[model samples]
Target: MPLDEESPVAQVRKNRSWEYAPFVNYGNGMGGDRSNYHFLSLGVEAGKVLTPTIHAGILSGQFQLAVNVMPFWQAYTPAPHTQTFVFQGVTYDEPVGGGTYTGASLTPVIFRWNFLTHSKRVQPWFQGAGGLIYTSHKFPPDVLVPHGTPGGTSVWNFSPQGGIGVHYFTRPRRSIDLGVNAVHISSASLGDHNPGVNASIQVQVGYTFWK
Candidate 1:
């Protein structure tokens, strides 16, 4: 028996195959305090072609560890020379300090759309994602205070972000992707409080698995 060239079943079978990819990315953070960070990520992506021109998939990546610290200053005054110093209404003018700390644990969930899946050599895609970020900092020695001290603080916070990227397919199952992402993590404090935001760019290489 001969098969019809225009049969819908044959078309469906051709589009139902699987695909996957692996990639790496590098970009700088934007907004809040301007800073830079680099990331290395690897994952498996699988998708079925719903139509000749459309495809979709999910991705998960892990961040080993990273550090970020912003220089900040605060005001303080030494104890009064005498009890009458307070009665005299004395004021201190020296203020300002510095500190450094380390933070880790940041990851993202990704969703992508392939609009040019039908093309043989060149394919373009768009993506969007959101995830949680965990960060903490250690105060400087000079900033530490006694049990009753009321000015020093330590912090931990959560961050959320999203971004877009374009994938250029070099082979039937491989491509290079480049994009940008933005993140926001609320501030944590032991004494004083402030919120912070981070932004970066992503570049990756992806491979597809077919059934």
Candidate 2:
């Protein structure tokens, strides 16, 4: 049948030169309310086809050498610590907005080798990303350091991540993704404080615009 040959995931696999995906991710490990980390992004991708088709292998399917430039990034991380203390006649109280680490980021690049599967309806892939992020304030210390780090958090940090995700197609060249990613934020010891926020798991949902 024509539908069998021109499947949605197949069209996605054939989109070798350029593509786009706008995604959102939500993360909360310990509690339901006090800890919710989220981000919204638009990924601009470019790649070349590894082959016309890959039917069988350790990773069987359409393999692409893909690179994504996430130009727009908005992140939210709610902190869990709010303790007050005074030293040398100076009072320090963790602010309320410290729990709401809201900020914007631009262009965190990711290089990905995608192993799209043979199934017409579904495709699974694994990827890793390393980039830098700049935040507005030095608050929301790493969870391990609930009392806040010495000199507070850095305005700039490095992000390293790895994750797995699957695409489910609803029509030709169109799909939604369910993915899990692990993200880390740290200063790379370049700043006054290097304590980082490590969210072991982040869940993401997204849509692909294939070309």
Candidate 3:
């Protein structure tokens, strides 16, 4: 037997659709050590819906696998300056790293859960994602490097993040999206020193095409 065309279950069926979204995100550094930093990025997200509507009461939804690539990523930090530090019982004045850092970012793995709503115009989702970043210069400037010395942090870092958002359909197969994400950045000991950005809160806006 064929699925009833008017059945409620047929309304949210999305077993094998592709989604493409172009978005922009802006963020500010948070936590103890990264308060002064600012971030901006532009990217596109591509995904394929892999599951049918699962009727699990409130958690009824579809699963999606996505990837985001941001070709233009930038971080703004305080200008270069000097500070005081104590290393191994000796107190010394060291320089802090600061300035505009340019980079590219790619999130190759994004696990998303799209919740079902009776309304045809709205859909909500939550996702957990991991990504890699490559900067033109070392990131999250070191706090204890002397003036003539270099090499503290790494140019490569990893970002693990989670977010929730909603999509509002404006027309057939087109929608607008808004989301907020909590992101953590770290070098994971890839460098001699790891002055990672502990936390950041980012806001994203995008236009999505459902195909």
Candidate 4:
């Protein structure tokens, strides 16, 4: 017998899909420095049909490289200044200076998320993920307590992130997603040994495969 043209099995087979895209991120550190930090990433996702109104999928992405410059210190002050102050049995005037510190991180991991997919060409979503981040530092030599201090140390840290955003599908199988994501890296103290919180707002774009 000839199969019906509008058979449900045919529609189900035709709706299978996948998606991917390269993304760029822009935001600030916990300290609110609007530096131009950027990253390149590739994401792959697979979706399964649950019902006409529902779909679910897992997403994973790898960051090729991520870089940033952050400021640490704002100013420095010395104890009460006196013209006739004696230091090491010698009279001298102590000078005070102010500066900032900077750092960067580069580590990649696979992030997984289960999304409640929407049907509109433009859809909104929310997801949470955790991964490993390798962090590094770059501080001013003069800014350190002692001179001739080395910079650039890498540490392994865990990052947990979550966000909500809208996805715009400009083409049949491609879309641009802009959203705000909060990423937290466990405190890492190195060099001068200062431990602090590091976080950022992430923006990304992605393309769908077999849409």
Best model per lDDT: 3
Assess the local accuracy of residue 150 in candidate 2 as a C-alpha lDDT between 0 and 100.
30
Q: State the lDDT of candidate 1 residue by residue for 1-211, as single tens digits.
A: 2222333223323554454444333344454323422333343444444444323333221111111222221111232222121225875442222332334433434455444333344444455544433324322212223432222443444445555554444444445555565544444443363424344444445443334
Show pairs that collide, candidate 2.
79-99
Give the C-alpha lDDT of model 3: 0.84
Each model's total of backbone clashes: 16, 1, 0, 5
Overall lDDT per candidate, in order of appearance: 0.38, 0.61, 0.84, 0.40
Candidate 1: where is the Cα deviation over 4 Å? 1-19, 36-108, 135-159, 185-194, 205-211
Q: How would you encode candidate 4's per-residue C-alpha lDDT over 68-153 as one tens digit per residue? A: 21122111112222224466888765332213333333323323232333343545556565555443333211122234232222
Q: Which numbered prediction scores highest in TM-score against the true structure?
A: 3
Clashes of 2: 1
Q: What are the runs in model 4 whose C-alpha is more than 4 Å off? A: 1-16, 31-119, 135-154, 187-194, 207-211
Better of 1 and 3 by TM-score: 3
lDDT, candidate 3, 48-156, per-residue tens: 8888877899998888899999999999988878877778999988677788899999999999998877766778899999999999888877864545323678889
The global Cα lDDT (0 to 1) of model 4 is 0.40
TM-score-sorted candidate list, best first: 3, 2, 4, 1
- Counting only residues 3 or more apart in sequence or on different chains, how many pairs clash (N, Cα, C under 3 Å) in candidate 1? 16
Once fitted onto the true fold, the runs of candidate 2 whose alpha carbons sit more than 4 angstroms away are: 3-5, 15-17, 29-56, 62-97, 142-152
